[model samples]
Target: MTEPLPHPQLLLAIAALRDRALAADSLNALGFSIANDPYPLLQYHQALVFQQQGQSLELLCVSGLARPSEDSPYLVWLQRAVRWIATQLDDDQPRWLGRDALTPPADIAEGWAEWWPKGLWCIPLHDRDGQRLGLVLFLLDAAPAPALQPLFEGLWRTWAHCWASFARQRRLLRWRPGKRQLLLALAVAVALLLVPVRQTALAPAEIVSREAMIISSPIDGVIQSMQVRPNQPVEKDTPLFSLDETTLNSRAEVLGKEVAVADAELMAASQRAFDNPQSKSELTLLHGRVQQRRAELAAVKAQLQRTQVRAPRAGVAVYSDPNDWLGKPVSTGERILLIAEPKQPAMLIQLPVADAIALEPGAEVTLFLTAYPLTPLKGKVLETSYQAQANEEGVVAYRLLASIDGQPEHARLGLHGTARLYGERVVLGYYLLRRPFAALRAWSGL
Candidate 1:
């Protein structure tokens, strides 16, 4: 059933209240778009929102704009105001504070107060759980404008809740270290300086001979036999390998027959020169032919002598295996094997360009061979490449040499290992962050 119609004045009041409710809903529905509005920001000069973050408050926006990351003069001046906000009553609400009464406790308080002598309207926002959030501030003019007071007073508490909710979603603005946290950070900084760290780099290494001589094929031939096995101890003049001598012997027989024929012709030409004066020129030409033939014969013989390869000095034949070389055809200058002393085995390292570090002569080197990983080898850096180039694995690297302090009994040529090169002592922090800091500096051009 319908009750009696309300009085006209009562109906008007009801309509006004409905309008206010609709306005509040519209303002709240504006959402984040309010940050882009120039009218409110221009009229208010600046509107700031601060939100509660973990253990601290974050500044969300100022003058319809998102807060900047850089430190500003305003934040330095607002420190006192922030402290007051932190210690406010839990039941605090919005209010207006005059610039004269609200004295900021900071070194620049006089200048800061002068700039805002007009005063500021403060709105204290709270969550539904009754927890005090942060504040929404608006700058005022020299003459106190009470126009916005009623707008703030008449609105539903939910209207203010929107600003609080938004502030909570913004990025943090500032960090202030407490006494305990400051002390802990200071202690850590000191410890980082005290710790001793070695500046080091890593590279792949291999066992190498210090006074090794490479044996190469002097003449093109197929291997007939392996006179000495790989890693076999041999004295100077020991037969290392014999090339196939079938061609050498056949060619020698042909040369011998040619030499005999040339000598017979020269003797016959000498007799003819004595009998016929015109034949003397022909006799001299025949003698010249004989000499040329002898020179050719000498060269063939010299090559034949080199068919049986021999060690130049007393050392170990450093080839991989006999099966690898036997019956295989080799060209001139092709390396067959090495003759290493085995008395001094050094380390050859290929330091990649990305992992390069400054190394001085006599710098310490620690290496671990794959065969004897349990035992590490100590060495001293002897040399480093002046440039970067590709290594055996086709990776860009710098060649480095290090001489081992002592030789191991089981050390063999071509054995692979990992080597660590030490440069100098550095603070723990610098040692750890050196690369990252360098990269940052390069990218930022700082």
Candidate 2:
């Protein structure tokens, strides 16, 4: 400015000012620039600065480069350079030259050789207190002329004072993906361990009958007439069917005549005994004849009554066949019909033994018929056997009976359904906890 500086000096001064501006901008934009960080914009700016200063630059300390030990001769030379720069500043302030002759602290120097190699020049960055904070290692493709050294030194002095502020902001704003992922995984694990899980509910029951029987005819003859049809309600002594009785009636009439004559003879003998006062032999013979006639009469009457079959109790009559019965004959002991009383209707179920024991007298039962799924019929536990019986499939099951509550309109005498016997109501937690163990036991045949 005073009479203008010489041409080379003016050029040098402009380049240094440009580089200073660039360094300040990079510090504002990136906050901090580490030695080996691959920031393209910062690298481009550094290239500009190098071109303005008439120096050729290269970057050697990139992230993926191979490493060398800290004790190498090259690092020894760097320590010497750092010592020389430290002596140039004022008493309270320190400086650094971008050269291999600067020494770094032991902690920072330990991994330095691996992060940096040949051609890297160190510039010491310092805070307001003149304490060394970090080092910026610039690299060059060829040795710089001695003339550019003073410009670099002046730039370092200006930028080094701002390093502390830049570093603090960098530390606060940094995003470390690897560290964040580790913390997230740890949090997930803790949440899983703390969460509580509940148990399962109880399983449903099963029920079977022990005293089911099929009724049959005892003789072979034409039905003649049917006194009952399928599902017909009847009471005890109700005539179920009647065979043709023409032949039986004729035999009964002859037996009645013989009985009448025997009675007349017996009466004559009794009167004679009273009149004569000593007719013992005649009385005995008359009594014997009377007994013979009575026996014959009873036999014929039994035969006649056999033709008419009657129901034993109040029940719904169900014929074995529905085609016809008015003129059909059924053989002895053949199952021609069945009468199922409402009070004694068959309550069949296939119950597990463990459940059967819990079923006591008067235990509540709910029946769900396949025909009427929506309509639930009520019942009570009538009986249960202590021992288990092997079913047709050879599976052991206990027999049980439940008396139906009201006469359900849709419940046919022989209808099939499932009977849900209500046992004790327990905590839902117990059933869930024991379910797995129970299943395991069953699978292992324990």
Candidate 3:
């Protein structure tokens, strides 16, 4: 004998239910579809969907509602009823449950007549692996025919697959941290931020001479030559550099001729004074003119002597490349070089304004030389500029001087390094946020 063909409406209803279940992208959406989408295939007064939580069922959705309200009397009663029924079931399957078969607790029994119909068809949902997914309760006026059990089972199993996938996806997509854990983590982070830390700032530094004699141009003239090379040791009165003497020599020669001419005129007046009494008066005027010319000559000679600069005391010459200064014109008192004691090298730091911190005299400092970075040299702040100025690098910075604790063999004049200056203690949060706060204040003018 051939099997009877399924009804066209039943086939359409089954296809529709399957389509909705497959289309659901989230656990909540799947629960809603499961609760309401089966109405065409199976006529029921109401439907409730539940998810299996450890040892109990959690009411997930109710038919005809987007979401089941937690405080709804109907939902609250269904949750208790479904949970109790889930525990009483012996195996994972679909079956018709009569209201009379259940000896519910007093709380549940009191509302049974008012809320439910004669019976409900309980369908247990499971994944392909036989893991229990949840339960679906359909409140029907009459028990479903046994022949439809296979169709109901097949539909719920398909939904279980979708439910399992959505549940796994939901867990992977977001982290649901508990309230206590979140609070504890936040508390720990805040405490760490409040920790006391020593504030420090880094600046470009160079080993320099302390209290060294500064060599400057004595007159406004062009530099002719440098007698000593950079870092060359010299004794007292050693020739360091010389200014161009071509003009000074020419001026001196003219002054000398004027002095000679003044003397000759004075001699003639002195000789004629005996011959004419009027010449005596001329003699005094001529003598004054000769004295004036001699004074001018003396001044020129003094300037000529100052053209050749010499070291006043014994030390090493500290300056940049000699080629930079050669042929360069300099004004009087302009710094040319330094006669520095190499053994007493100090640190010259150019602290950028953006990285500037509260610094005071005698504050701790550490020097990390580019050449010998492994061995750090300790120092103390000797002086700090009251104002900021642009450095050689064109960065606006404050000039700071620091005294080395002890003389190191490699600590010589003109050696460059990085200086870490330590300031007063502050909270870690402030130390990290100090720059950001300063930038914000500057931008917002607050």
Candidate 4:
């Protein structure tokens, strides 16, 4: 007589053991390899997992014969079935059932087994500790031959043990923190949450002059010379720089000649008018012309006088170099340099848009100077910008003005530092989440 077909369970068990022991990545082929074998004929074979913590069922793998991709509709229905069956798995009782006995909704159950499967065997896969790892689902149109029962039991037990062992390894690999670590972390979190502190925002800051003045060109001209050196102290009306006066001098000379010519013509016209009555109007017109020429001459002389630019107040000439001004053409109203009295300095802060802190007047400010990082000085917010503008650092930011307090003598003008501004007090957690939560709310419009 012809030998009967070998049992599928035995074949798959051998395949699983050999593939795993040999380090071959052939697990992806095991399901279909067994299903296609004409041993204990099966319509479908699938592996599913049940998590004790999540209490959810998920399809892990399927027989190669009818494998579903991750995004398949059958897997979708299977997920829904797992949720429905989660409650039914109240106990560890082994189960064997027909299609009608399934707790899954009719459509999902019937649809998953497209041909309305006749029977299903639910075998439990557990660990050495007897913890349930998952289940193996085997579908068939008829019960296996009685002679094959022993082989089926032994093979399935081996395969199930294999899967559970692998699952345990994965769990161990993803081990969570121990109780001591968790407790320590919890304590630290509690302390941070309860401790009261200032809600501060940091930005780059510089010591700017409180009484700063800008000296600018009164008219368009080229710089001929500098009268005062950079950082030189000067009194009000002290000459700062001299502009080229070649064109102005020439124009003044022309106006003077015109004035003289007009004066001589007026004199001659007066004499003619005294000799004759008809020349009176001519004399009057000549007189007005002379006055106009004199006015022009005076205006030119005034411009020529201003060529020597002077300091407006008692302060230092704060330009970098005298060489920068010599022969440099400047437009009217263009700033040449600054004149700031060596007095109390103020803080100029540029807070980047991303790091903006809302603070009202009198909010505490602390500065750490670049020259002396260890030493911190104090200040108070004096003003804040309503809108963002680009600062010298090429970043869009809100400008802040602050009054320095208890500044040291070494903290001179233009000294750069970092400024920290404290806003209204808030809990540590709230301060940390404030920006991210605001961003999320703005993005979601919730």
Q: In candidate 3, how many Å is residue 214 off?
A: 0.8
Which digits, one per residue and each the tens of the lDDT, describe model 3 over residues 350-375? 99999999999999999999999998
Quote the positional error of residue 301 for candidate 4 in Å: 0.8
The C-alpha stretches of model 1 lying farther than 4 A from their native spots are: 1-183, 186-196, 321-324, 327-329, 437-446
Measured against the true structure, the TM-scores of the candidates, in listed sequence, are 0.57, 0.37, 0.61, 0.58
- Clash count list over all predictions: 0, 17, 0, 1
Per lDDT, the best of the predicted structures is 3
lDDT of each residue in 323-378, candidate 2, tens digit only: 56667777778777776654545456667554342556887777777777799677
lDDT of 4 by residue, 169-261 (tens): 677889799999999999999889876667889999988778889999988899999898877889999998989999999999999999999
Q: What local lDDT does model 3 show for residue 29?
A: 89
Native-to-model Cα distance after best TM-score fit, residue 288 in candidate 3, in Å = 1.2
Q: 431 in model 3: Cα distance from truth in Å? A: 1.9
Q: Where does candidate 2 stray beyond 4 Å?
A: 1-225, 234-238, 243-290, 310-315, 322-357, 387-396, 403-408, 425-446
lDDT of 3 at 293: 88
Ranking by lDDT: 3, 4, 1, 2
Worst 10 residues of 3 by lDDT: 145-154
Question: What is the C-alpha RMSD, rounded to one decimal, of candidate 1?
Answer: 14.4
